[model samples]
Target: MSQARPTFQPVHRTAKMPKAHTEVDPLLDALGGRGRYQLLQYFVSKIYAFTAAFQLLNFVYVARNIPHTCGQPNNISDIFTAIDDDAFTINNSDIFYDKCSIRVVANISGDAETKQLPCLYGYSFDERKELSIISDMGIVCDRAPLKGLGQTLLIVGQGVGAAVLPIFSDRFGRRPVHLISHMIVLALGVGVAFSPTFTVFLVLRLILGLFQQGIVLTDATIGIEVFPTRYRKLVAFLSNIGWCTCHLFLPLVAYLLRDYSWRILQLGCCSVSAVIILQFFFLEESLRWLVANGNPKQIKRLLKKAARISRVDYQHVLDVYDSLHSGHEQLDTKKEQEGTLSKEQADALLTEPVVHTVDDETHSLLDFIKDKRLGLNVAVLWFIWFTDSMTYFGLYFTSDALAGDRFVNVVLLIVVQMPSSVAIYYLVDSIGRKKTCIFLHLITGFGLVGATVVRELMGNTGTGAIISTAFSCFGFFGIFGAFGALFFYTPEIFPTNIRNVGLGTSSAFSRFGGMLGPFAGLLSEYVTWAPGAVFTCCCLAATAMVIVLPETKGKELPQTLSDVKGWYVTTDDKRRMDSIAKDGDADETPGQHGL
Candidate 1:
């Protein structure tokens, strides 16, 4: 028997294996992910971030209020001299300088008696500083409440636009909406600078807010969709860095134009929007969008161009795309002819790929809420966005209240964000999205709570002020880092069909937080610890919420609703899927099993 076994011959197999079509990620990788094409896309998309930062923070300087006194009444020509010599005192002593009313000695029945009179004339502003909306429009005194109206309206417009514009992007396309919004922003921005009155300025600011948020949404959408998953973190970092760069330079620009009209600063900020003209020539539509929306011709054209720039083989990419669409049916026919696959195996392999069609059926926020798992995810993202905006803008609006020079404080706040962005660039890729988000939230919560404790214990002493500023910088570092992470994470969670819609909805919530941010600073008047405490609580709550979200780091961006549904699953669902997979494997025909 041993001699016979040694003489036995080996059987040869001759079954031919079918070629598999590449998936989107693998196809993109083959076309050279993170290549020159991706870089060019990133560069163009990020230019809008710079302009957005400029518009958002410019108001801090543009609406600044300076010390002023009631002007001399036209009836009393020399009242200014009398007031300077202390002959007149402030009637409304409740206010430090009684900027609204002045006390004057009246010759009532030939007896000197002091009487209070309103400033019928305009205000006398400090000549040392440049003019602001407050000084130019006399927004002080009784009109002081109007100081923040422009900024408030701007934020309100952003909220409204965020709620509305992304629907158009989702329906039409990201590129058209982005370019149109950019052009409108430029026009509105210029219109704001040339505003004839504060009313006109306020109207323009509101309109500018709408288009600016549009630019933000569309730019981020296009940016995230064009790049491969691995490069998304990098895309997010670059977007943040662009904002930080503009933020860092904004104070310097304001300082240089300190002696000029606020309108000059406005004009200068709008000038950056001129970059849009270049985008008209260079920017490409998102390849992911092209695929999901079924613009195969455009996809092929984009792939060919990308291949040329990336120096990859265009024919190979075309072949992959061609096979991806047609291979299953063609291969199934061959397998059926050969009679190699069992009925179940053939049915499994023949199942059509999920296609996201642009139909009349609407995809809205309601759809997000209707799906239990997605609703939970969206709800968590809303809270995170709300907290992020509240803390970020809250800290910014209150920068002048910090210990150091106002300019220095603003600069420090902006500078710290640079390192925060860089840290997120690394942490999101290394620790993963869920952990990174949680870690950043904890840092923010602790930093803010620590600052509140220190401020409460030490009061407003010089030491306390310095320590509080340091703590604020620490907290801001975390919030800014979390912000960058959100940009990367939000897009990954949503499918291509509704990516803009989901991000837009989240941004709308953030605008609500932004609208409340200035008011958060006002809370310090009643409770010194109120703003910090609110921000800390928000951070902690966001941390707890983050723990429930699935980790998205290094995962491919979902293309359809089906892909998203698979991400967060129950134990039962996982088991069912596994069982089905196992049963299919067991039923597979011999010599036709997957390699």
Candidate 2:
């Protein structure tokens, strides 16, 4: 019996087609995939960008640490008064004055001791600019930790949303999940803006974070999957540009209304959220998704729309469907068995969409670490993703810590990131993913180290400020480049069934780093260079981890863990694709969808 078992045929079939002719999604590629149709869909999806830009960074001004001091009954409140009355060092570059206390006057005499007392009357804030939750809620000095808590908690909601929202996206559909998130985020933004109590505002921030992360990631997945491989970078590129555009606009809005209430800014940002409803009118569900779900009826309608938008004749595509792959035979079979059929009925049968058989097998997060190669890849990339967020949030969050004007510094941060994202889109194709990651990571580390060194050598003078700003710009540029390209790489490595979850979970892991980053920025209170130094070490460590991942550039996306487990899957899969490429309808992979 054992010997007879060996007599069976080999597992693999002989490949009859050329190796170079790999099969692709013909509907996406062959029908002018990157045409205005797909391009328009990609661009319209940027409404999420506007929401993200204003919502994500809204915390910056909302919690900005304006000038404050001890709550005296009727004495010095302004910083200038404290300096004039000899309460503080005259040109206190080091801020040697104790902000928590002030010298009091004897009944009718001169000066008294620097009495260490709390700001019991509630400290007054520099309200020349925007009124914020900080000014209203008194989240100062002792309550300063609450600022970090608020930021961290907001990311907590983001983490929860990242894990939960994508499940809805994968199970039901991307559109519904996104639309729901949009509505909730709109309501939450308004709620946070007009929140009467600090507790309510914090709670709303948490809820807002959750919905914001969900909407952005789901929209990102839809945008990416709609395009064929050749135009994928365009989607990523446009998204970054959209985010940067919003950031630039935000600063202008903040500056213009600096003397006004912060609620006005929140209302302005929420107003842009109306664009989400407009998406419902024009955006169609993914054709690939329809094919996978075996909805030939909807698939046909959407395919016709795509074809028309691409300027191709819809009837010619229909004719091809009618002529291909036992299409007429299947319709005839149904007609004979059931008696007669109408034109629409026959047409529905003509479009024999490829239906994906669901796999009973499941993938767990720990499964990412159990497979030898996959585990190692997951661990390393998770670290890279972590550092990506740390450096990103750390840079901007630390803007106030820097010597220059906060607005100009933030604007510079965004301006530098713009070119880096663009550079990576073009550069990833040339240098390969491994080198791109390592090189950019090293550059970021160098900028951190360089800034740390200059700040130490020259002290925090104007010259040192210029030098530090230059280096920080370098770090920001590198961080943006590496982070943007990594998004393309991370999802491409995971299989489709778990792709949304995988991206979501990895994002949650990145949020772990983000949650801690603001605290690192807060460390600037103790030492000027602490945040940069800590972030540099983290970036350098990530540089080493970059090499553990295999080069994925110019490769077909891995369809399953089996595809990732061994090299043979790539070779075998390509052979199978080549064999089916000659017949477009036959090329659709069995039990597979978009990939």
Candidate 3:
């Protein structure tokens, strides 16, 4: 009933002798295994952890030194007792002095003697209405020039450190550079703790910023490099989470320790720094840097260690490594299958792909700006960074104008920022880069606008104004949280060769913005509310300008400028060109103008 099937006779053949050498894994053979990358990422995260801990410690140190004690100083109370101070009729409730340093006192009616003085620090008191404003002259008399400079220097240092970190990371390895940064910060902490004069303390604060730059730069660079391209944003963003967390607790620290001396805060920070130094010693150098430096032995050992920790089989890891180095092994499968290969055949089959490696040599700064794309991106990032810091620090410094309860206002501001920071780390990878940036920028701009409206409505009103102020705080806080993520995003867009340079330029502009902050305050004195309006406008501009940027969500890093531009070129061609340059094999002949 069915069609007859065709039958064929099997042909007998003799088995061929196997070749002396053969390749097992071609894909793995071309490039090294994934283990090196994995280990490097792990090291990067640890570096972030240490830096985060130190940053928190710095905040804690500052909180403890606030100069307010819950109870009276022992000597004063004891001396009073010895003198039979009960003659003064001081009760226990009145005996305890509250910490009220660094407060804004409102002066009403412009009279030096008869004017009412409102204590900006009385938010915790039940009889809040008892506070009354003193005259503007009295208010002006209360604030010291040294106090202004102190605030200015603290922020300026932050700007400078962030701007220059890229250079430190690229030159010195991340671990050593961070350790040095920690030492510098620790010293600054000590200086801030013990300085008898305000001027010396302010100067030291600026110096502390220089060291802080290394902390931020090295941690960021290492963090980005260690992770897979897909996770770089997440790592960078999560790293920012530490900053937000520090901010959230800032209010609590300011409240609980507000009564203590500032020196105590610095001492606590120094203690934390010592602990961080110990934790950091166990951290390994970036495996990425080691491999890029062509340290095979170290790479293998690091990979083996990571595998052991990850609970992966050592043999399986070895197989992956073997596959990665197959080209290096130089297996001659075809010749071996036919017959044993002669020396000439072995040599011919053992061909290797050329790789261009970076040399540990100094380069000119001009080299960073050689490429147009890099230069433009750097410029764009600079504006974005400048605006970001301007809005964030500017608003925070002026919190007194918006809310009646300064402590609660600042704490609320910091708390709202934490979730936004955590969200950025989570979404940087899940959502594409461009979209995420655009969305956040838009939100920040609107948030600032919303804050302005609230500020306007709060125009000298009482309880209602206070409530509106808290809502506005929410908006301002979100803008700052977005800023933390942007710090990492700008650096990640560039190639390794120019990444540090690009980031440095951007960060420098950011510092410039910080330097200009005190000026903004001065400007506000001349034109009230103008700075806030300008900040809102800048946010809008940054948000819109971000649209012009090319999306780099999951793209592989290019080896050359042309590759980076997505110009037509194969990976092999780029590799060959790099090798020729490194080996000095190519003549120094001029190429076509465009290339």
Q: Which candidate ranks first by lDDT, i.e. highest?
A: 1
lDDT of 2 by residue, 185-276 (tens): 99999988888877888899899999998788777777777777666667667777777887888777778767777788778778878888
Identify the runs in model 1 with alpha carbons over 4 angstroms from their true place.
1-22, 74-98, 105-114, 128-130, 327-365, 399-406, 569-572, 579-595
Please give the CA lDDT of all the candidate structures: 0.75, 0.68, 0.53
Top model number, TM-score: 1
lDDT of 3 by residue, 1-595 (tens): 9986533211111111111211212212222333453444445434444333444334323421122212233354442443342433223212323343221122224422211222232223222111211110111223324445554665577667765666666555666777777777777767766766555766887777677766666666666655545556666556666555545554555456444545654564355456454536455665455543446687678667666655566667665555545433333333243234443443343332322232233343355356564456556777888887777667655654434454566456556666777667666677866667667767766655655566576662676456545645655655665566666676556555455556666776777776665466677777666776788788788877777665666664332343344422222245444554456443331222222
Q: Which residue window of length 10 is worst by lDDT in model 1? A: 7-16
Candidate 2, which ten residues in sequence have the lowest lDDT sum? 13-22
**What lDDT is obtained when candidate 2 is compared to the true structure?**
0.68
Error of 2 at 407 (Å): 3.0
lDDT of 1 by residue, 226-310 (tens): 7777788888788888877778878888888888888888888788788897789878887777776777778888999989988
Task: In model 2, state the lDDT of residue 519.
Answer: 74
Model 3 segments more than 4 A misplaced: 1-143, 163-165, 249-259, 314-365, 399-410, 457-471, 518-521, 557-563, 567-595
What TM-score would candidate 3 get against the native? 0.66
TM-score of candidate 2 to 2 decimals: 0.79
Tell me the RMSD of model 1 versus the true structure.
8.1
